[model samples]
Target: MSSLFTPLTLGSITIPNRIGMSALTRNRSTGTVPNEIMLKYYVQRAKGGAGLIGLNGPNVLGFGIKFRSKAGGKLPTLSMKLEVKFMLSFGIVSLTLIPVFLRPIIMLAAGVPVYAPSAIAAQGGRFRLLPGEPGYVTPTEIADPTPLIAQFKQAAINAKEAGFDGVEFHGANGYLVHQFLDSTSNHRTDQWGGSPENRARFALETLKELIAVWGPDVSLKLSPAGGYNDMGMPLQDTIDTFGYLLREVDNMGLSYVALVRFDEEDDGPRGTAHDVVETFRPFLTKTALFVNSSVTPAEGEELVKSGKAAGVFMGMNWLTHPDVARRIKEGKELDNAPDFKSFYGRGRC
Candidate 1:
C-alpha cells in the first residue's frame, strides 16, 4: 500500500489521505482578500487530488491583499467570501497566518511600520530587502508580549469566522515567534527574551491564547535551526530550544506540528545535526508530526513506516502539478518544472 494514499489523523480530524499541500505564498492577494485568480488556483489544486490545502496567511493581520473588483469593488469581496465558504464546505483546507510576516504585510498595507521580536535586520534580498538593507520597514521591537498575544488570539478567532478547518502558526522561517526562539535575534532584557524559557515565553503564551480560542485544531510550523531571513542561532541552542518547545506543546493536543527541515543528506548547518524531525519526534508524544522538504514519494513512505513522520507536505510541486497527489499515487511523472523568471514575478508566464 502507498503510504501517501493512507489516511492519517491530525488531532481530532482524520485526513482522507496523507498527501497534503504545504502553504504556498503566491503574492496574489489584493492586500487582505484573495482574488479570483487565487480562488481559481486553489480550486484547481483541490480538484486535482490534494486531501488538505494549507492556505498561506499572507500577513500577520490575517488579511490578504485588498480585493480589487471589476464590478465596483463588490465582486472581489463577494468572490472571496463565497470562495472561502465553498472551500470550507469541501472540508479540505487549513488557513494559516504567520505572526511577524503577516503583521509586516498588514502594516505595509495600512501604510505603517512593521514590528518583530527584536530590531535585528534580516539578511538582505530574501524577500524585499536589499543586500545590505533591513528586510522589514521600521521594524519595531516587541517589548511586551501581551498586545501581540491578544492580536494573535483575535486573529485565531477571526480565522474561525472565515471557515478555516484549522490555523497554523508560522513559527518557522525567522518570524516573530522564531525570532524569540533564536537567542541571537532576541536581545531583550524582559521576560520575553534571554533564557530559553524566557525566549519561549512569547510563543507559548501566544499559542496558549490561540488555543483558548481555536483549541487543538491549531497547528504550528517550525524550523529548529532556521537560517532563513538572517537567522543563525547556536546549533546546540537550536536543538535545546526546540526540544523544550515540542515538550511544551506535546500535551496541548495540537492538530499537528509541521517541521520544515532539510532532507536527509543536505549538508546545511542544521543538516549536519541529527534529523531534526526524527530527533524531535519523540517529544511530540501526543501531537501529530509531519516534515516538509524535498522529500520524494519513496522517502515519504519510509519516513511514515519508520515512525518518523505522520505524513509529508509538498510545496512547489503543487505549483506546477496541481494534481501532485494523484500523480504520485499513480506513479506518473510530475509536471512542475517552474520557470525561475515566472516564479520570481519577472516574467510574463
Candidate 2:
C-alpha cells in the first residue's frame, strides 16, 4: 500500500488519508464575510478527499497584508508610488490609529471580542481568488481583523456549527500574521514588535483564545521564506521567530504545524529555506510536521525516516485528482492533474 494513501491521526483528528490540501488563494471573501462560492469551493474539496483546507484571509489579519484589490475586483499592480500616495496624504502614523477607531464600531456591530497584531489593513489572498471568474470578492480595500477576529471566531464557530472538522490558522502567506512575524515589515516598538519573540506574541495569544473557543485540534500553517507587503525579516530572524513560535504552540498542544517548504535556499535562511529545513524541522517535536511544496513521494518518505518530517502535502496535484488518495492507495494511475492556470476563480474544465 502507498504510504501516501494511508490514514493518520494528528491530535484528536483522524484523517482518512495523508494527502491533505494546502491553502490555495481563491479570492473569495467580502473583506468581512465569505461568499457562497467560497463555501461551495471548500465543501467540494472536503467532499473530494481533502483532510483539511486552510481558509485564506482570516488566517492572518494584520496591517502587513496587502489587498491591492480596489472597490471592484481588480487588484492594482502595486508600486511604491501608490503606497506613497496613500501615506503622504494621511501618513502611516495615523494608520496606527485604525484599531482605536474600529474597536467601538465592532463592539456596537458584533457585540463580540475582536483582536489584531497591528492597526493596518491585511489579507491572506488565495491565488486565483479574484472575481469575474468563479470566486467571491471583486477586490476592495484590506479589512482590519482586530474588529473582525470575533467574526472569524464566529466563522470558526460557524464552521464548527456547520459540522466541519477543525480550522488551521494561515500564518504562512504574506498575510497579517506573517506580516507581524517578519521583522523588516514590523518596526513597531509596541508589544507586537521589538524582537522576533515579541512579534510572535499576538499569534501566541490568539492561539490561546482559539483553543479556548475551539479546543486543541486546531492546526497552523506557515512559510518562513516569503516576502510580502510590509512584513520583512531576514532568514535568521524568521528561523528564530518561527522556531520560538513552534515551541510555544507545541506546549499548548496544538494539533498540527504545516510548514510550507520551498526549493531554493537563498531566503537568508536558505534559499526559500530548503537548505535550512533542519533548523525549523526540530520544532515539530510535539505535533505532526507537514512539509509541502513540490515534494515527490520518495523525498517525503526519506524525511519521515530521517526524522526530518512527519507527513507530506501536495497542493496543485491534488486539485485535479481529488481522489488522488484513493488512487495512490489502490495503485491506480492518477487522472489528469489540474492545470495551475485553471485553479483560480470558479471556472474549470
Candidate 3:
C-alpha cells in the first residue's frame, strides 16, 4: 500500500488519504457569491476521493479582490451552508475554506485602493498591468491593520457557522498577507515592518485571530520561494523572515502548513529558498507540512513515504482529473490535460 493512500490526522479531523486537492480559484462565483456551479465543482472533487478539499471563500467584507468581476460583495452565508452540507454528505473527505485577500486592477474600478503594508507597486506581468496602465495603482499603505484582522476573524466565525472542518489562511502568492511578509513589498518603519520579526507580525497576528476561532483546525498556505505577483526577497532575508515565521507557526500547534514550491522558469527575482519544503522543514517541529505546485502522483507518494510531507496537494491535476487520488493510488492514467485557456472566466463550470 502506498503511503499516499494512508490516513493522516489534521487537528480534530482525519483525512483518509495523503492525496489532497489544493485550492484552485475557479472564478466561477456569481459576482462575489458562490453559485451552484461552484458547489457542484467541489462536490465532484470530494466524490472523486480527495481526502482533503480546499475551497476558496468568496470576497470577505468587501476588502478582497474578485477575479475579473466586480467587488464589494460578501461571501454569502447560504453558499457556505449549501456547499459544506453537500460535500459532507459524501462522508469521504475533510473540507477547508481558504480566506484570501488579493488585490488586482479591477478593485480600483470598484473604488477600493490596493491596501498593503507599504505603498510599493507590483511590477507588470501577464496578469498584472504596468504602473502606467489605465487602472494600475500603487497600494495604499495600511496605517492600522486592526480592521483587516477583524475581517479575518469574522471570516473564521463564518466558516465555523457554516460547518467547515477547517480554515486555511491565504498567506502566499503575494496576497495581502504575503505582501506583509516580503521585505521587497513591505518597507514600513513601523511595528509591522523593518525587522524580520516585524515583517512577520501581520501574518502571525492574523493566524492568532483565526486560531482563536478555529483552534488547531486552522492551516496556512505560504509561497516563501514564490516570485508570483512580483514578490521576492533577498536569499538570506527570505530565510530569516520565513524561517522566523515558520518557527512561530510551529509553536502555534496548528493543523498543517502548506508550502508552494517556487518555479525556476518564472520571470522575476527568485527567493533564497528554491526548494521550499527542504529549506524550511527544519523549522516545522510538530506541524504536518503539505507541499503544493506541480506535484505529480508518483512524486507525491514518495514525499509521503519519505516523510518529507505529510500530504501532497495538487491543483492542475485535481482540476483536470476529478478522480486524481484514485488514479494515483491505482497507477491509472490521468484524463486529458487541463485547458489552460479556459481556466478562468465563466461557462466552463
Best by lDDT: 3
TM-score of each: 0.81, 0.66, 0.83
| Candidates' C-alpha lDDT | 0.65, 0.53, 0.70
Error of 2 at 280 (Å): 1.1
Q: Write the per-residue lDDT of candidate 1 for residues 245-345, one digit (tens) a residue.
A: 88998877788888887533332453324467767888988887888877677878888887778888788788878788778878888755887566634
Worst 10 residues of 2 by lDDT: 84-93
The regions of model 3 sitting more than 4 angstroms off are 57-110, 126-135, 265-273, 346-349
Question: Deviation in angstroms for 257 in model 1?
Answer: 0.4
Task: Evaluate model 1: give its TM-score.
Answer: 0.81
Among these predictions, the greatest TM-score belongs to: 3
Q: Cα-based RMSD of the predictions, in order?
A: 6.1, 12.6, 7.0
Estimate the lDDT of model 1: 0.65
Clashing pairs in 3: none
